[model samples]
Every structure is written in C-alpha cells, then in structure tokens.
Target: MRRLLILFAAAVAAPVLAADPAPEIRRAPVPPQALGVAHTLRTIPEACARLQGEFSGDAAAPYRFAVVRTSPGCRPRARLVDAAQARPSPASGWILNDLIRVPSAACATQQAVVRVWRQPAQVAPPALDPQGRARVYLEDSLQQARAGRLAPLPAYAVSLQVEGLPCPR
Candidate 1:
C-alpha cells in the first residue's frame, strides 16, 4: 500500500515539476523597408560590400537595422541613404548591405532607424504602413502595405556578426 502511494505521488509530481517550461522564442528574418534593404548578413564585410553596391561606396552612411514589434506581428527592416538624398527601400526577403558580426565574434549591438522623406505629388516614395508594419511588407511580399493607403517610406538597417566575419568599424 505504501509503495503504491509513493508511485502515485511521484507520477503526479513529475508532470507538475515539468510544467511551466521556459518559453521558446522563434527567430525570423528582418524586413527590408525598415532597414532600406532586405538582405541578411553574417559579417560586417559582407554588409560593407552590400552597402558599396547599393550606395556605390564602402564608407559608412546613414543607416539602421532593427526588429520592430507590431500589434499583429514582428518584422525586420533595413534602409540605406546616399549623399544625394537618394533612398532605396529593400524588398521583402532581400539581402542586407551591412554585416552584423566580427570574425568569430557576435555583434555588440544592433539597431534600426526610421527615415522619412517628402516627395512631390508625382514622385513615388517607398511604401510605409501607418501602424508600422512596413518591415513586414518589405520583408514579405504577401504582407506588403498595411490597411492605410500611404506607402511606406524607405528604411535601411544592418545585421551583425552573422557568419563569422569581422564587424565593421
């Protein structure tokens, strides 16, 4: 009788002890519009190459890479701006121009910046959502454009320390 009670208690407590396990956080790709580009980087050198290709220069310009949270979901956004005020918004799942990691080292920090530009009536600006889902739209074609009619503005960002390349100075 005592053995049966001990077994029952053990069984009951086992499941209870296992309950409330740590929450699993799933990681997804960052959106393009938020970062001005859609590319995912493993290193800062790769990011520099991307930046040079996009802006035609290796020097650092105004840019940002970040993950934004919204009411419905989360997304990444990247953007790049030039000295001529030329801004290009990245498409969904597009490659980023900046790398976030150093050789065999993780990124120290990652951030995203939002830039707004005023265009003429006929001039088309990069698309943006009023509720801030531009990252989603830019990252995923299916998610393009939020409920509002306003197009999302172009944003540029960078991911660091991705595939073991050294981070940019």
Candidate 2:
C-alpha cells in the first residue's frame, strides 16, 4: 500500500513540476506622436532639476532621481538616469545598468563630470510609480517628448571622492 501511495504521489507531482512557469508580461509600446521637439539640456542633473521644478519639490510627492556615474577616474561620461526611488528589489526600484568600474591601479584620478544634450531612447528616463506597476501615460509622454531634436543648453554636474562617505565598491 505504501509503495502504491508513493507511485501515486510521484505521478501527481510529475505533471506539476514539469509545467513551465508563466512568462512575465510587460506593457506594449505606444505609437509615435507627431514630429516634434523638446528643449534639451546638457546634463543629468539638469534633467533632475527640471523634474523637481515641475513637481515643485512636493514633500509628500517629491520628484525622485537616480544619479548615474561613470569612471575609471580616467574617462567620465553621462551614462543614464532613472527618475525613481532607488529600491532594493529589482521589480520596485532604480534598475541599474553596468557600473563604470574604475580600477585604482591604472587610473588614480579625481573630480569628474558627465553631461549629454539629450537622453537616448535605449536609456530612457524612468517614470516611477510607488506601486511598482506599468506607468503608461507618464512613460508615453516622456517617450514622445524625447523622440525629437533637442536644442542643447548649457547645464552640467560634478562628482568627487569625499572622505567619510559610505560607499559600496
């Protein structure tokens, strides 16, 4: 009876275990808007400032920013930015790209700056939602606004190594 029960249990679990997991469903892209233009600035900080001003730095709903950096301490460049609160979980936070690892052995440098005339589509801005779901209208609007010529403006930012600052290598 025990051997029969074991066989039965194995048979039941075999189908369940062999079944594939459901694929994650992401939102589809929206259609393009008319050929338009968005005024451009020259740095990620400028982009952050623009959003902050628009949001009026509201305490309850403050504009969030993800500061991206590049290094080697030898070469510096504006990598990418995501407008969302940096969360611990992958599904609910600033999804980071590859880090600009600067080896101290070859490059022992200081002070860096990164800027860009416009944010690219591939590295588009993040339309954050506290609930961590698809933000259709917000993402769509940003996408539309950025899909055009950008008139460059003079705006930039700087970074440095500060003593006593907690950093994760």
Candidate 3:
C-alpha cells in the first residue's frame, strides 16, 4: 500500500515539475489586418507601453502586441513574429523578415510575398523606474520579396516575422 501511494504521488508530481515554464512576454506583435495597413507599421514606444500596461504587474506575463498602420488608404493586417527569430547586428539592434501571403484564405494556394521590417533605432530604457516600468524603442520598415526565390522554407518555420528588444528586461 505504501509503495503504490508513493508511486502515484511521484507520477502526479513529475509532470508538474517537468513542464516547461511559459515564455516571458517582452514584446507584442500585432498583425497589420487589425490596424489597417498595407505598407508601413511602426512599433513605437508609446504604443508598446500602452499595450504592456494592460498586462498584470508581472512583466513576464504574455500579452498580445497591438499595432497600427500609419500609411494612408491602407487596411490593417496582422503580422506575427517571434522574438527568437530576430537577428541582431552592429548596425541594427534587431531585424525581422516576414513573408506576406497573397491570399487571405488559409486554404488558398498562391505565391507568397516576403516583407522585411527592421528598427533603425534600437535603444533600451534607462533604470527600472519606481513603478517597475522599463521602456524599449523600435522603428519598423517594410519591403516586399519572395521566399521561393531564395531557399526552401524550413519544416517547422511558418510565415512569421522577426520581433526583438536588445536589452530585454
């Protein structure tokens, strides 16, 4: 009886301890569809700050990134990119590339368009303020291209842009 009870408790606790912790939500990526933009999308400090405020006190808590298109006559669309994919260089703090699909439907089999966005100015905020507030600033630029031209897409790699913050808190 003792052995069986110990085995059951061990089994129950194993999964709980072994599970991977949720990722820290340092940056949010909003699709252009929501903001109505076909060309330009800027992830400025003010917008990101406002979006982060909605989350709980925990900075690690995951929250969706809110984005808005600044171009005229452009409809809002969503562009999602993970922080891990962002590449950093001396010239730029973080860089992201996105493949813009030609069709809105998931089932549509059409040639995909590629777009690249990068923050020219990447700067980290000063000291952690009294309210535990930290700031990260980034600028976005978009250009169109194609994926089928360069290299075959990776199996696990789907259509996602790059997102990053150099000095992530």
Candidate 4:
C-alpha cells in the first residue's frame, strides 16, 4: 500500500517538475541603415562569390540586397531557393515558424531576406471553436497586418536567425 501511494504521488509530481520554464526573450534596437556595395571575387569555384549592398546591422537583412554564387561551378540550372524565419525552442532547439521562396533565376543567384520579429510569447486563454478545437495562432506578419494588427518591426535582437538555401541557378 505504501509503495502504491508513493508511485501515485510521484506520478502527480512528475509533470509539474518536468515543466519547462518560459524562455527569455531579448529585444534590441534596430540599427541604422547604411548604403554601400561590396564585391567579392572568389578564386575557387567552391567558394561563394558575394555582391553585398546596403547594411542594416540586422541578422535577417544584414544587407539590403546580396547576390551569391549558387554552386561551385558556374553552371546554369534550376535550383531550389528557400528562406526560413526561426526562433529558439526548448523542445526542438529551434522552430521554423515562417518560410518564403524565390523562383529559380539564372546563373547569378538572386538575394532574399527573411525578417522576423522576436517578442516574448504572449500567454492568453485559448480561443476554442464550436467543436472545441483551439484556434490556430497566426504567425505570419503579413496576415496579422491584413487583420489590422501592426506587426512589430524587425530589430537586431528580435530574430534568432534567418536561414537560406544556396541561390537557384
């Protein structure tokens, strides 16, 4: 009987003890935009050749525009081009909450930027539908703007990171 009671108590406390604390969200002021163009010519085909334009100091859009070589060889071919906006997640380490893509271009890769707003997760009562399912939260800034909510502007510390695939050929 004592063992059974101890097992029950442990089961009751386990979830509470294992619960993860809310993540710390950091925010930083946006950096001033600088205008300039820097060209990098790579000697090897393996190295990426970069043409960077404008500087905002933000990770998402470090430059207003940037053109990079898609592959080591200068071959014209179709390639998959994708960009994702991500945030740190305790369970998964990072979660890609938003994504965008650009159509395949020529040998010279076209540049893209994925801007994200980093803010503390808001705790609110779930909005349940008639069937009792929780409403889906909108993560897209454009959708939020269409709904009349002003999306937070991107800042230096708001976004965790912006990942992109090699330029499409």
lDDT of 3 by residue, 98-159 (tens): 32322212111111222333333323335576799764323211121232322222111122
**Whole-model lDDT, model 3:** 0.30
Over 4 Å off in model 4, which ranges? Answer: 1-94, 102-107, 113-169
Q: Which model is ahead, 1 or 3, in terms of TM-score? A: 3
Better of 1 and 2 by TM-score: 1
After TM-score superposition, the amount by which residue 128's alpha carbon in candidate 1 deviates from its true location, in angstroms, is 23
Instruction: Residues 78-152, candidate 1: write the lDDT tens digits.
Output: 233341344323333222332221111122222222222222123264467887544434545444435345444
Candidate 2: the clashing residue pairs are none
Q: Please identify model 2 stretches exceeding 4 Å from their true place.
A: 1-85, 106-169
> In model 4, how many backbone clashes occur?
0
The deviation in Å at residue 141 for candidate 4 is 27
Candidate 2, residue 93: how far the Cα is off, in Å: 4.5
lDDT of each: 0.31, 0.29, 0.30, 0.35
